[model samples]
Target: MTDEHPQVAALLARSHRLGADPRNTNYAGGNTSAKAAVPDPVTGDDVELMWVKGSGGDLGTLTTGGLAALRVDRLRALRARYPGVEREDEMVEAFDHCLHGRGWLPGGEGTAPSIDTAMHGLLDAAHVDHLHPDSGIALACAADGERLTAECFGDTVAWVPWRRPGFQLGLDIAAVKDANPRAIGCVLGGHGITAWGDTAEECERNSLHIIRTAEAFLAERGKAEPFGPVRPGYEPLHEDARRERAAALAPVLRGLASTDHPQVGHFTDTEPVLDFLARTEHPRLAALGTSCPDHFLRTKVRPLVLDLPPDTPYGETVARLRELHEAYRADYRAYYERHAGPGSPAMRGADPAVVLVPGVGMFSYGRAKQTARVAGEFYLNAVNVMRGAEAVSSYAPIEEPEKFRIEYWELEEAKLRRMPAPKPLATRVALVTGGGSGIGRAIAHRLAAEGACVVVADRDAESAATVAGELGGPDTAVPVTVDVTSEEQVDAALRESVLAFGGVDLVVNNAGISLSKPLLETTAEDWDRQHSIMARGSFLTSRAAARVLTAQGMGGDIVYIASKNGVVAGPDNIAYGAAKADQSHQVRLLAAELGAHGIRVNGINPDGVVRGSGIFAGGWGAQRAAVYGVEEEKLGEFYAGRTLLKREVLPEHVANAVFALTGGDLTHTTGAHLPVDAGVAAAFLR
Candidate 1:
C-alpha cells in the first residue's frame, strides 16, 4: 500500500484526461504508462513494475484491466539480448516472459503489452506518455522538423529521427535524453510526441506543453492559407446542396471503398474538411500521404480525391469517380508488390478507406460504423498536420518503403489474427420500414444481433427512436421518420438511411394498414390508403434502394411482409386483402427484374399476428373478431386453431423468416415466398 495504488489510479486518470480531447490524441492512437514499486506476492521484498496501456486499447476509455504490467528491470535487461532492428518483431513474443507473474492485476490477468511498452519501461522516469497529437505530428512531418523542434521548445524538447516503432526506437530515445539533461521530452520525427516526468502530474504537464508549444509555433510563423487559395471550380456547395450531393455520392464511394471487403460508411462535411477539399494544394499534399503510422493505417496511404468540378454533369461525375477508383486500386496493388518481402504479411486489401469529394465532403469506410467514423476522424487529423507543416515548411513524410513495411508488418498481422470472427451480417446495413413496433421492431433487433447496422424507419418518430435505442443506439441502429404514403418522405427516408449507414444492403417493406370491411362498405380512400401504405410504399422503398444497390454492384435483399389474406379468401377484407396481394406480386416482379443485378426479392406470408401487433391493437382485432363471430380477446387462439400446426404466429417468427430469406445460405432462393403462419394451407404459394 505504499504509493503504488494511487500511482496506478493516477496513470489511468491522466490517460483519460489527455485522451478526452481529440486534439490531444486520435482514437486508440497512443499509450500511457507509470512505474511503481509494490510488494511481491511470493517474496516480502518490494518489486518495481511498469504498467502501460495495452495493445488495441483507447486511452479515453481505458480501464485497469486494459493495462499490462511487467517488471521494469526485466524489460530493460532485454536491451542487451536484443539482436537488432532486423529481428525486432521477435522481441514482442519475448514480452511474455517479462510479465510480472502473468500480470499485476488482482487476478494476475491483464492485457498484452503493446509495441510501445519498451519506450515506457526503458525510460528513466516514474511516468511517461506517448501521444499522436495533431500539433506534434505537424512539426514532426515538417521537412525541417529538427530545426522546428529546436525553435519551438529551445532546449526543453529534443528531436529524434524517424525509425520504425520497436525496441530499438526506445533505446534511441533514451540516448537522446542522456545527451540532453534538461529536455522534458523528444519529438519522434515523422511520428508523434513522447514525454516523461518523475510524477504523473508532471508527465501530463510536459506532454501538454510540448503539444501546445508546437501549436503556437506554427500559428505564429506559419503562412496564411497553407493549403493554398481555394480553387475556382471547387467552392463548397450550399448547405442543403452539400448534403444532397453527399447522399448521392456516398453509395458509389462506399462501393469503391469496399473493393477488398464489405464496409460500413461515414460522412463528414465539417468546415475544415470542406475548406481543405476546396484548396489548390490539397491534391499535392494528399498524394504525399499521411506521416504518422496511425493516420495512414486507418486512412490508407492516401485518399481518393474527386478531380472534376462539383458542378459537372451527374453522369460525368460518376464516370470520373469510377475511373479514379480503378486507378487507385491498381496503384495500391503495385505499392504492395514493390515492398512486400517473403515474410511480410499478405496485402490486406486494395480499397481506399477514405474518399474526398470536392464541394461535398469526406466519406470513409471500414468493417463497422465506429471504425469507419474513426477513420474519417484520423484523416481530419492528417489534414490538420498537412496544413501546419505546409504553412511553415514543406511537408515530407517517411519514405514509401517504410510505410509499406508498417502496413504489412508481421506483428500487425498477428494482432489481426487474434481478433474474434465476425457475425453473419457483420458488414451489412438494413433498413426496416415500420420498425418502430410489432414485427418491424423484432426484425430490427434480430438484424442488429447478427451484426448488421439497422435503420428503423416509421411514421412515428418517437417509436422509431425508442426501437433504435433498444437496438444499441447510433452505433448499431438509427431512426428515421417516414410516412410511406408520400413519395417525397419515402425518398428522404431512403437518403437518411444511406447517410446513416453508407448504403442499404437489406430492405424490409413491412409498413401497412388494415380494414375489415365488405366490398360495398369499403370506401375509395380506404383502398388508396391501404395500397399507399403497403404496395406503393414497398415500391417506393425498393426503387430508391435499387438505385443504391446497383451503384454498389453488391448483392442485396428485399423482404415483403405480406399477409395470408393476400392469397387466401377472407370475409370482409377486400381493401386490405387487395393491398397485400399487390405487395406479394410486386415482390415477384422485382425479384425477376433485379435478379441480374444480384438483388434477391422475397415475401413472407403470416396469419393475423394478433399479439404485439400495432394493426391489431388499433381496432383491427375487434373488427376481425366481429366478422368471425369470436371475442376480440380470443382472436389469436382462433387463428392458431385454424392453422395445421395450431401455433399462433409471433413477431419474432416473422423476423426469423426475413433473416432466412436474406442470410447467406439462401443466396440461390430468390423470388420465392416463405410462410410463417404455422402452416396455412390455403395461403401456400403453389
Candidate 2:
C-alpha cells in the first residue's frame, strides 16, 4: 500500500530512519507527515491529501494502516472554525470531519488522528517532522533556549515560546515559519523540535541537521559534569553489590508504585543513571521534573530520589524508602489539588513511576514489563536532556501549573480510556519450577497466554530458555536454571524472578523426580532423593516466595503438583508416593500459615500422565507398567480403565487445574486439592 504512494512511502521511510535512533525520538513520542496530490476516486481529479502518523503509533514500526489520511482543504479550513485556546480540545474532534474519502483504509477503517495532526496539516511545507530528540529537548529546556537556538543554528531555526500542544501550538509554529522566510524548523520551548521541507528527503535532512547541530553546540559549550561532581560515598556500588541491592529494592519499589494498581518493574544501573544519582544536584533537578510531555508522561512529574547513600544499612534504607514513599504521595496529591480545574480529569494514580537510589540504580514501574522498561528508557533520555541543558545554561522546564494541565487533560484521559481491557493475569508474575517440559511447560504457557509475566525455572538451562522463548522472550517470559533441591538455587531463582519482573505473584512447585520400587528393593537413598526434590524443594520455594510476596503486601498463589499415588496406595511406588503425600500436606500447612497474608496454597492430584511425560520416560513407566501387568505403552490405558471416567489425563489437564486455582476465579477457594485424575474413587478426598 505504501509502495503505491511514493510520497507516503518516503514519509514512512524517513520516519523509520529518524525513529530508529533514540537520539531522534522517544518511542511513540513524535509524528511525521506528507502532503500528496491524489486523484479523487469519484471526481477523477487531483486533490491534495495529508497522511500523518496516527495516535499511539510508533514511527519506527509504523504501517500504512497506522497513518490517518485527511483532505488538505478540509484540514486547512479548520483554522476558521477554531475556538479560543480554552476550547482548543474541540479541534481534535474537528479533525475527524477532515478525513479523506471518509478515511477508509485496508479494512475500511480510519485511524484516530493524533493531537499533533494540526501541527503537520497546518504547515505549508510538503513534508514535516515533529520529533522529541534528546539534544533538541536539551535546547528546548534551557532557561535561555531562544538565545541558544539563535547561537546554535542562527536564523535558520526559529524558537517558539512554550505553548501546550494543541491547535494553538500548531498555529504558532506555522505562523513562526511563515514569518521567517528562511526558517527550516523551530525549537518548541520546553517540548521538542519541528522541521519541514518541500521534499521528504529534505525534511529528514533538516531534522537531522537541527538535532546534530544542537548536539554539537552542547558538546562544545557544555561544562564538565553538568550534574555536578559526584558526592562523597555516592559513587555506584560494586557490580555484584549494585545488582544485589537492585534486586533487594525492586520489590519494595514495585509495591509502593502499585499502591494504586499492580505494576511490573524494570531496573537499570547504567553509567548515566549512576552518575546522576551520585551527583549533589540530582535531587533538585529530579524535583523539577522532566520538561518534554513524552518524558514526564512516562516518568511522572518527578522521581522519588532516595536520600541515603548506597552503603546505608538495608533496614535503614528500607525505612527511609517507606517514609519517602508516603511523602511523595502526599506531595503528588497536593500538586493535583493546587492545579486541578473543574473540567480537569480526575487524578489517576498518585504513586511515583520512577524511583532513584544512590549507588544502586533506578526502578521504573508500569502494568507490564515493556511499559516499565520503556518508562526507564524515557527517564534515561530525560537524564541526558537535563545534563546538556544544565551544562550550557540553567535547566528550566515548564511551570508546574502547565504540566498539571497537560497531565490531567481530558484528551489524555480519553486516550487512557481507549486502551483495551487488561487480560485476566495482566499484572501477575508467575514462577514455574520444572517449566522446561511436560506439566510445568504447559503451566508456563497458560499463565503467559493469560498475560502474566512468567519465570521459567528448570534444572536444564537449555530447556528453560527454549520454553521462555516459546512464551515470547524476555519481556513476556524469562528463563532461570535451578536445582530445586538446593535451597540456595531456589532462593536465587526467586531473586531472578524479582529482578526480571519486580516480584512473584504466582508460584508453581512442580519440579519432581519419580522412582518406583517394591518395599524390599526401595533404598534410603531413593526415598531421600524423592523427598528432597519434591517435598523439601516445595518448602524452600514457598518460603522464599512468601518473603517477597509478604513484602509486596499482595496476595499470591502457590500450586503444588502432587499425585493420585499419594492417596491411593499402589505397588512399587513407596518413594514417589511418600513424596507426593508430603507435598499434599505441605499445601495445607502453608495455606493455614500464610492465610493471614492472603497467600493461597493448593495442590493438583493426577493419575498416570504418560504422553510427553519426562517422569514416565525416565524408566518410571516400565516400573509402573510391570506392577500393572501391562506394556509401558499401555500404561495410560491400563490406568484409565480402572477409573470411573475411563479417560487418560494429560499435561494440559493439570495446567488447566493450575489456572483454575490461581486465575482470579477461585480467589477465595484455596487450601484444597483439585483432582485431574479420571475420577479414581480411592484417590478422591473425603
Candidate 3:
C-alpha cells in the first residue's frame, strides 16, 4: 500500500480546512477525494472506488462520507462525450448514475458525484489525488515558471499548461502518461498538484512533500501582498437572464476545460470578492486567463461579469465576444483535431468560448463549482503577494496570448473533474435557549460538536455564562441573562445577539415553565404564569428572530421544547399540558408565516427528561417516579425505559432533538411535533 493511505482521513480534513471559504468560487476551489476499498458487487473483491469531494462541505469537518464515488471507466467516457460541461446541470445525472445503489449520499436515495469526480476518476496509477494548494499555486504562478516547478516538484513531476476540461483534458493526461510512464503526478500550471501513490498514505506523503516544498519556495521569495481590492460597485441585472445564461454555458466550459468544479449558474447577490473580480482592470479574465491556465478547466476561459459600465455598448459587447469566440473556437478546433486524431467522434464538435458583460461581474457566465475552500486559501496567499506586487509594479497574470493558448492547449489541461453534491446544512449556525444545564446545555454542546458556533442563552446568568464559557471560552459565547417570558428582556437579548454575531440563525425554545395541579386546585394566576412562559415565550422569541432573519434574506431555524404530556392528555397538570398544546400550535402558525421568509419552526416533545433542575423536582417530584413505582435513582430508568428504545431520555438526548430542528435540515418537516421519548406514541401528527 502507498504511504498516503494511512493518513488519508487526516489529509482530507487538512485539505478541507485549508480551503473552506465561499469567496474562492471565482478562483479554483479545493477538492477532497479518497481511494478506498469498496467491494465490487460483481466480483465481491475490493475494487478501487475513488470518493471525490461533495459540494458545500466546508473543510473543517470533511469526512470520507462527504466524498462521492464514481466508477472510473464510466466517468472517463462522459468526459470524452462532453467537451465543456463545467456549468451544466444535465451532466449532473451522469454523477448520480453511479450512486443508484450507493447509500452514502444525503437522503440515501441517489446523488451526483462532485464535479471534481472526473479528476479523481482519471488518476490511473496505484492512487491519485489533487487539491488547490494555495502556497503551491503562488509559486507556480510566479514569474519564473521552470524554476518554481523545479523547486516544488523537484523534477519528479511534469508540468501541464492550462486548458479547458473534459475530453481535451483527459486526452492530454493520457498522452502525458504514455510519455512519462512512471510519473507520480503532475502540476497543472496555475492550478493545484496531483499526487499519487500505491496507497492513501503514500499519496498524502507526496502531497505534503509538494506543499511543503512550495511553502519553502514562497518563503524565500518573500510572501505575497494583497490582491484585487477593487471596489465592486453594484449593477443590477435580470436574475432570469443570468440563470438561463449560466446553465446554458456550464456544459461547454466543462467540456472545454478539465476542472472538477460544480455548475454554479449564477448567484442573485454577489459577495465583495465576486464583485471585485468581476470589475478588476482586466475585464477579460479568461482571455488573459486565470492566475494560470489550469483554472480554465474549472472556471471556463472567461466569465461574463454582468452589467458593465454604461459606456460599453450592448451591441458592441456581443460583437466583441463573437470575435473572441471565433478566435478561441478556431484554436480549440485545431488543437482537438491535432490531438484526438482525424474524425475521432470525441473531437467532432463544440469548441468552448467565454462571455463577459459589464457590472454584473463574471457571474452571468458559466460558474466553476470548485472547492471554495481551496480558492479561499489561495486568495489569502495572493493577498500577501498582490500587496507586494502592487508596491513593486502593476500585477500581470500570464500574458494574454499565453493565457489563450494555455486555455485551449490539449497538451496542458488536466483530466475532467466531476464534482460532488452539496449538503443541506454545511455552514449553518445555531442557538439554543436555557443552555446553562439540562437539555439546553446538551443541545448547545451537540451543535458545537457538529462544527457550528452554538449560542447558549438562559434565564440563569451564572449557568448561561458557564455554558457559553464552555463553548467559546468567554469570547466565543455570548451569555445573556434574560427571562424569555419578559418581552423587554427577550427583545434586548435578541438585539444584543444580533449586534454581537450578525444575527441569530437558529433559536431553540428549550426554556419553558410547567406547573402541576388538580383542575380545581389550579389558580388563575398559576395558569397565567405557566401559559406566559411556554406559549408567550415561544411566540415572542420566534417573532423577534424572524424579523431580523427575514430582513437579512437568509432563513432561520426555531424549535420549541414541549412535553409528551401535552399530547397524551395526562392528568394532574392541566395547565402544563394546555400551555404546551398552545406552544405546539404556535409552531404551526409561526411556521406558516415564517416559511415565506425562509424561517422554519418545529417542536420536540419529551416524555421524561430525567435531568431538568427547577420544576420537575419541586412539582411532580416522586409523583413522576410513582408512575413506574421505582425509587428516586431508578425513577429515571423506569420513565426512560417505557419507550420502545428501552433507554432513559437524558438531557443530552432531548438536546439532540433541538439540534436537529434548529439545524433546518429536514426542510420538509415543520409545524410538527417529534418525540425524543424512547418510543412513546404520544404525538398526534397534524
Candidate 4:
C-alpha cells in the first residue's frame, strides 16, 4: 500500500495478502482498485467503479477472470432501479434482469457480475472492500455495535444500521448523501464498512491500514490477545471440543460448500469454531439472512455453535433449544407484522441466528458461513463506531426498506447465474509452433485475424520471418526462431515473447516432424527425430506457457498440431503417428490439472492440411507422385475425392478449429481431438 496510484490494470492483480491463516499461511479475501484506472478526474475515463471482493471467491484463488467490473454510471443506476421494484414477485424479475443486464465489469469484460456488485457500488468511496476476516468479525459483535466501531476505528468512520445489503443499502447511501452531504465513509452495522481514497494506492493504503488497526484494537480490547504461546498454527482451536460436530456436519455441509473440494477438518490450530460452525446444518443463518437484512441470503446466518461443556448432555441441549427457539421465530413474525406490506421487505426462507453454546462461542450462519462471519465482522466493527457516534447522537441506517426488499428477494438470484465468460484469447498474444508455412502458420494468421498478437515459432528463420513480415510486425504477427526441443531455446523464446508483449495467453504447440515411411522402413534416428519435435518439444513449450498462464489465472490455451494419424493407424506413417499419438495422450492428462488453474489444453488432428503447409511445397511432392503413380500436380485433386467432405482441406480450416477450441463458447470442452480432415481415413476404410 502506497500513496502512488496504480494502473487501471494493476488493481487486477497484486501481492495484497491480508487475510492470512491463524497460523501462518496467508490467504487473501479479494482484489480491488483503490487506485483509479483512469488518471484524470475531469479527463479521466468514466469506466471507473470500485471493483471489490465478490461475495464468493477466495483471494488466494482469485484470478484476473474473477474480477467483476462495474461502471460508475451503472452503479448509480442500481440505486434508482430498486425504488420502483416493490413486490417480491416484481422485484425478483428485476433482480434477474439486473444480473442479465451488463452492469459494468472493467476486467470482467465478459463475465457474470458479482452478486454483491450493488453493495460495492453503493459505497461513495473510490474503492470498497468486503472480506471474511476471522479476527475482524470477532470484534463486530462486541455487545454494543457502534461503540466497538469507535473503539476500533475512532471517529474517522461512520456507522449505519444493517439494512439487507444491496439495493436498499445503495438507497440508504444515496439518502445519506442527500442529508449529511459530506459523510466520508460509513459501515453497515451488521455488514462491512466503506472507505474511499482519491487514488487507488491511497484507497488500498487506507483499507490495509484500517484492517491492521482493527486487528490492533482486538489485541488491546480482548485482554486475551497475547501472541506469546499462540500463533496461527501453534494456537489451534480445540479439536476435541469440535470432534462430534465436525463429524456430523461433514455430509450435510457439501451443499453449502458447493465446490467438489471444500476445506473441512478440525486440526489443533486455526479458527476452530469458525471452520466447523460456519458449515452448520441448521437454517439459522439462512433464516436470519433470508428473513430480514443479514448474511442469511448469501450464506444463511444460522451458526451451529458447538462449545459443549464436558457435563452438558448433547440431547438435552438440542431439545431445549428447539422448544425455546420460538423467540427467534416470534421476532420474525413480529418484524414481518410491523414493517412488511405488499411493497415492504419480504422474507424468503426460515433460519436460526445468534447461536451460543456455552463453550462453542458466538456464530452467525448463512449460505456461506465464512461469508456470514465476514458480514457479521463488518457489522460488529461498525457497531463500535455506532456506539461512539450514538453517544453524541442517535444511530439509524440509511433506511430504505423498499430497496432492501428488492436486493434480498428471490429476483437477485439472476445475478448469480453464470455461463462462463469469453476467453482471454479474444484479444491477446498467441504462439504457434511451425507457423512459418503449415498449419502452424495458418493458425498464427487465423489468430491474428481474430485480433490477437501472433507469434510464429519455427526452425526455419527465413520462412518464419517471411510469414511474419507478410502478416505484420510484433504488434500483429512475429516469427520466432526456436528449436522447441532445446530447453534453453524454449525458455528464451518464452521470455522474449513475454518481453515483446506484456504477457502471453495462448500457446499453440503446432510444430512436428513427419516421416511417411513404413514401420520397417523407418530408421531409429528418424523415429527419434520425429518424436523430439512432435512430443518432447511440445511438452517443453507447454511447461513454459503453463507457468505464465497459471500466474495470470485468466488462462491460456495449448493447441497441439497432431494428425488424424494420432487417433488411428495411417499406412506408411510409423514415426509421425507414434509422435502424434504421444502428443494426444498427454493432452488428456494435462487438461485436468491445468483446467483448475484456468489454463486449457486440447488438440486438432488435420489428416492432410497440405494446401498451405510446408509439406505441400517440400516433402510430399516427391512422395505423393511415387505412391499414387500419378504426377504430383494431380495429387491434390485425387486426395480431395477420398473423404466425406470430398473437398480438399485448407490450413485455415484447421487453424479456425484451433481458434474455436481455445475460445470461450466451448469453455467446457477439453481433452478433445477435433478432426479437421475431410474424413479421408473413413473414405479409405469404407
Candidate 5:
C-alpha cells in the first residue's frame, strides 16, 4: 500500500471514494489528478509533473501503477504547434511524447495517461477532480443550463459550452480560470463538472457543494409529472403474457444482433425497465442522444425503437423485428457518413447496443453479460437524468457533432482494441454440479478459462465456495449449495444462476456416489443412495434447465458425466452400474424431447480416472484394487496399462472431451454418448 509520492497516495484514496459511489461515477468513467515536483532523469533539475488516472483502469480499484505522470511544461507548450487543429490525434501524440523520462513518472511504468490529462495539467491548482454526477448532468443537459449555472453559483463558477476534449478545451479552461481568480469550479455544458483546490479535501468539498446546489435548484421546482401513461391504443398486457412475449422476442433480437461469426449475449428488462418503457414519450426521448458524451461509449448514441405488439404471431413478429433492426443499422451508417471528415477512421459496428420494444420493454446486448449489464445501467441512469431535466426545463443535450467526436476518438477506440481475443464460450454461463473437486472442479476451471461465468454447485457448501473463490472470486464464479436429489433445491439452483448471470447456457450433471456390493449383500439403502443422485438428480436438474433455456430461446447444452461401468458392468458393482445406465438412457430420451427447443443433451462415460476423483477419495479405488488382486499403490499403473493409450486418465482429459461435445463443432450431434476412458474398447458404443 506504500506509494512513491504522498500526493499520489492522497489522490488514490480520494479517487477510490468517488468511484465506489455510483452516483459520482459509473464503471471506469471519471478522472482525477495531482500536481507535484519530480527530478528530471537527464538534466537533474526539478520538473513539475501531473499524475493523472490512466485509461482502462477503474478508479474504484486503482493502484499506484494506474496513474501516469507527464511533464507539465511539455504538455502546456504543445498548444503552440496545434494552433487550429480540429482532430485529436496530433494532440494525443504530443501528450505521449511528454511522458516523464520516456516512461511513467515513478510507479506507473507501462500505463497510458487519460485523454483529459492535457486539460487537467492546464488548470491552476494542485489538485483537480472531474466527475459526471447525476445531479450536475441534469442541469448541464437542460435547455437553460448556462442561465441556471449563473443563478445557482453566481460568479463563483464559470460555465463553458460543450466542446470535445482536446487542445481547444484545455485552452478554454485556462482562460476561464484566469478571468475569474476566485472561481472554485466550472460546469461543462452538456457534459460534466470540474472542481479544483490547493488541497484534495478542498477540491472534493467544492465538488460536493456544486452538486448539492444543483440538486436544491431542481428540488425547488417540485416533482415533474410522470411521463404520460402509455399511449391510449397500447394497453398493458397481463404479467404472464408479458413474460411470454419477452421470451418469444429475445431470440429474434439475439439473432439480429449476431454477426456471421456470431458472438452476442442479451438480457431482458426488469420491472423498472418496463415501467420506464411504458411511458408515452419513451420512444422519442429514448431515441435522442445520451445525457453526456461518456455514456455514448457504453450505450451508443441512441437506442433502437420497435412497435411490437403482444398478440402478434411469433413468426410474423420475428420477421418485422428483423426488418426494423436492418433499418436501424442503415440509419447508424448514414449518421457516421454525415459526420466523417478528412482523416476520420472507418466506422465500427453499426448494431445498436440498446433496443426498446413497446410491449416487452428494453433489452441490452453486448459481447458478454457484464458488458450488457453495464450498458443497461447507463440507460437506466439516462432515463432518470432526462426526467429530471424535463422537470426543470426542456432536455437539450449537446449537438450530434460532439457525440461523434467522443465516440470515435482514437483514445476511446484504443481501449477496446487493446482487449485480448475472446474464447469460444466467452460470456456464456455454465452450472457444474459437484464442482467442488475431481472431474467437476476441473470442468469448472476449464470453462472459466474459456471465458464463461461459472456457477459451482455442491451439496457441500464450504467446498463449493472454495472452488468458486479459486476460479475468479464472486464476479466470475458463484457458489450455490443444492442436494440435486431434492426437486425444490434443483429449482432454486436454476433461479440462482439466472439471478447471477441473467440466464444459463450450459449444465453439467456430474454428482453421484459409487457403491459396489453383491446382489445378495446390497441393501435397499445402498440401491436408493446410488439411484437418488444419479437417476433422480439428473432428471430434476435437466427439467429445470430446460425450462430456463426454453425461456431464453437461445440454444444450450446439457452434459451428463456417466461411467464406463454403465456400458459393461463389473462383478459386485450392479447398483452403481445400474444407476449410471439409467442416466445414460435418460440423456437420449431428454435429447429427443428437448431437441425441438434447441437443447442438446449428451453423455460422457469415463473410466479409471482416479487421480483426483471423489470416487477414489471415497475408498472405491482401494476396493477395486483389492478385487483386481493388486496393492492400492499399484492401482493407477494397473489401470493405465489396461487402457489402449497406456496413460492414466486425468480429470483434465475428461474436461477436454466435454468441451468438444458442447463447443459448436458438435452442435448438430445430439443424443450421442462419448467415451473418455482412454480408448476403452469394451465400453465403445456401436
Candidate 6:
C-alpha cells in the first residue's frame, strides 16, 4: 500500500534507491528517517514524529510499516536518563518505549525502531540519510580521516570520531551539528557518512555528492603509486590450478568450520578475492577491524588467514586446515574474553565467518547462499577501501574495544535472536541423484523446503536444470548432469557439489532404472542396465561422498532409495529386484564400515510411487498395469486398494522418510530400512 504521508513515502523511496546497490549498503547495514507531524492517537492534536527505518529490516525492500514512528520529544528527553555508554541497554529500552500511536502498523507490529532513532531525532533537518558507501568509508577509515574530510568537502561536512552507536554517539553528533550549523553532512570516522537536509531529495543528493567527491579524491591518489607488492612466500597460482585447488580446498575449509549443526552454505572465488589475498600486507591489514561498525554484524572483526600454498596436496592439507580452524576458534574466544565486560551477554560460537588462503583466495561462510554472497560483497568492499586508504594514507579502523562493543551490541544481537527457529535441515547440503524427476525430484524439493541446499543430479541435463529452476534457482538448488555409472562423471558431480556449496552433508542415492521380466525371458542388456545404474552408480557416489565426509570429520548421511520388490518377490521383476536387493545389502556393509567415520548409511523401501515419476513416464507403469490385468489409468487405484492402509504410496511419502533418517533424529541409527509403502504386509521389514 502507498504511504499516506508524502514525506514518509519519499524517504522510503530514497532509502530503497540507495540500498538497492550493494556498494552503498550490504545486507541491511544502513537506515533512513524523515520528520513529520501526525495526529496524536488520544489527543486530537498534531504531534511531531520521526519515522526511522526499523532495526534489522532491509532498506531495499522496506515498506511504510518497516519504518517505525516515534515521538521526537520523548526520544530527546531520554538523554537525561542515559548519561553514558554504560547504560546503553537501558537507553535502547527507553527508545523502544517511546513509540508513537499504536507503536506499529495495524496488522504488522513488534518491529524495533532503528538504534539510531535518537540520532535522527536530535538532527534539526526534516530528512536524514546514513549509509556506508565504499569510497566514503575509505576516506573515513584513513589515519588522517578528519583532515581528508576537510580537504574534500571543506566546511560543508562535519567529522565525528569512531564511537559505538548509542545515546553518547548521538550526543556527539548533535554537538558537531551545533558547532557547524552550515554543514549539510557529517563523515563518521572509521564508520560511515550521514547526510541531512530539509527534503529527502536534498538529503540523498548531499549523500551521493559527498561520496562522489571522495571517489574523485581517491581516484587522483590511485594514479600516484601502487599500494604494495605481493607478500613474501606467497605467489599467485596459475589460473587453472587455482580453480582446481579452490574446488579441492572448499570441502576441507567448509568441514573445518562446520559444527554438529553446520551453516557453511557455499564457497565463492573471484578476481577481487584473489587480488586481495595476493597483496604483501594483507595478513597485517586484514587483521584490523571492519571499515564500518555495521559490517561487524556480517563479517567478524577480521578474517582467518591460512599460510598454506595453493599447490599443497589436498590429502595432506586437510588435517592441517582442521588444526588451523581449531586454533582460530581458540584465538577468537580469547579475544572475546579480553573485551567482554561484566553483565555482557555470553559469547557466541567463535567460528570465523570469512577465511583467507594466501595463494588461493577468500571464502565467506553463512547459513545460506544469499548470506554467504552478502558477506563476500562486504569483504570485497573492504578490499577496495583498504587499497584506497593505503594509497592515500594508511589504514586505521576502529579500536578493538569499539569493535567488540558493536559486535556484541544488543541491537545487533537482536537481529539474529529475533529470527524464527531454523528448519531441521537448515544450512545442510544434500545431493539427490536422478533429481530431475520421479521419487528423486520429490526428495529434492522436500529437502530444500526444510532448508538444505540441494544438488539436482540427473543424466538428463535439461531436465535437471529445469527442476533446479523450479526449486528457486542456483542460489538454493544446483543442477548437475551426470551418468552416475561413469566414474569420471560421478567424480565431477561430487567436485561440482563442493564448488557450488562448501561440502556435502547428505547424499541421496536415488538414481536407478527399472527393468522387469521373468528369469527365463530376462535379457543380458536388461540385467546390465539395471545393475550398472542402480548398484554400481550407488557404489561410486557413496564412496566419493564418504571420503569427503571423513576428511571433514563431520558426520554425514547416505540414504538409498530401494524398492519393496527387493523384500517381497514380485512376478517378472528379476533384474530390478536383484539390483535393489544388492543395494539394500550394500547399505548394511557401508554402514558398518563408514560408521567409524561418522557416516550413516540407510535405505527407504517404497512401493507404487508411480504418479509424477520417471517410472511412469518411462512406461514402467504400463508394464506393471499389464501384469495386474488393469488399465494404465487404474494402476494407482489398484496399488492403493491392495495395501493394508488403502492409501496410495506417493513420492512425497518416500521423501518424508528420507527427511526423518537424515534430519539428525536418527543420528545413532544406521543400516536401517524405513518403509513408505502404505503398509504392505509382504514388504514389511522384519
lDDT of each: 0.91, 0.92, 0.56, 0.54, 0.80, 0.82
C-alpha lDDT of residue 487 in model 2: 90
lDDT of 3 at 621: 50
Clashes of each: 0, 0, 75, 57, 0, 1
Alpha carbon RMSD to native, model 2: 1.5
lDDT of 1: 0.91
lDDT of 5 by residue, 330-421 (tens): 99899999998886677877887887776566667677776777787777777767876876777788788878877887777777788888
Of models 2 and 3, which has the larger TM-score?
2
In angstroms, how far off is 568's CA in candidate 3?
7.2
- Superpose all Cα atoms of candidate 6 onto the true structure and report the RMSD in Å to 1 decimal: 2.3
User: What is candidate 1's CA lDDT for residue 354?
Assistant: 92
In model 3, the Cα lDDT at residue 86 comes to: 41
Candidate 6 per-residue lDDT, tens place, 1-686, comes to 12257777787799899988776766677789998887776787988888898777788998876778788888888877876777775687787778875443444443677677777887777888888888888888999989988988899999998877777777888888889988988988888888888888899998888888888888886634334676665676876777678777887787666653376645556766777777767777887857587676777888878766666777666667778788888888998999898856778778888888867777788878777767777887888788778878898988888788888877767777888998888888899999999889999999999989999999999989998998998879999999999999998898888878888889999998886577998999999999999999999999989867876677899999998887999988999999999999999999999999888999999987778779776888888888889998989899999999999988889999999998878788999988888889999788
Better of 1 and 2 by lDDT: 2
Better of 5 and 6 by lDDT: 6
Better of 2 and 4 by lDDT: 2
Q: Local error of candidate 1 at 323, Å?
A: 1.4
For model 3, the stretches where C-alpha displacement exceeds 4 angstroms are 1-139, 142-375, 388-430, 435-437, 441-507, 513-533, 548-557, 564-581, 595-600, 611-670, 673-686
lDDT of 6 at 501: 80
lDDT of 2 at 587: 91
Clashing pairs in 1: none
User: TM-score of predicted model 6?
Assistant: 0.95
RMSD of each: 1.7, 1.5, 13.2, 14.9, 4.0, 2.3
**CA error at residue 296 for candidate 6, angstroms:** 2.6
All candidates in order of lDDT, best leading: 2, 1, 6, 5, 3, 4
Task: Give lDDT for model 5.
Answer: 0.80
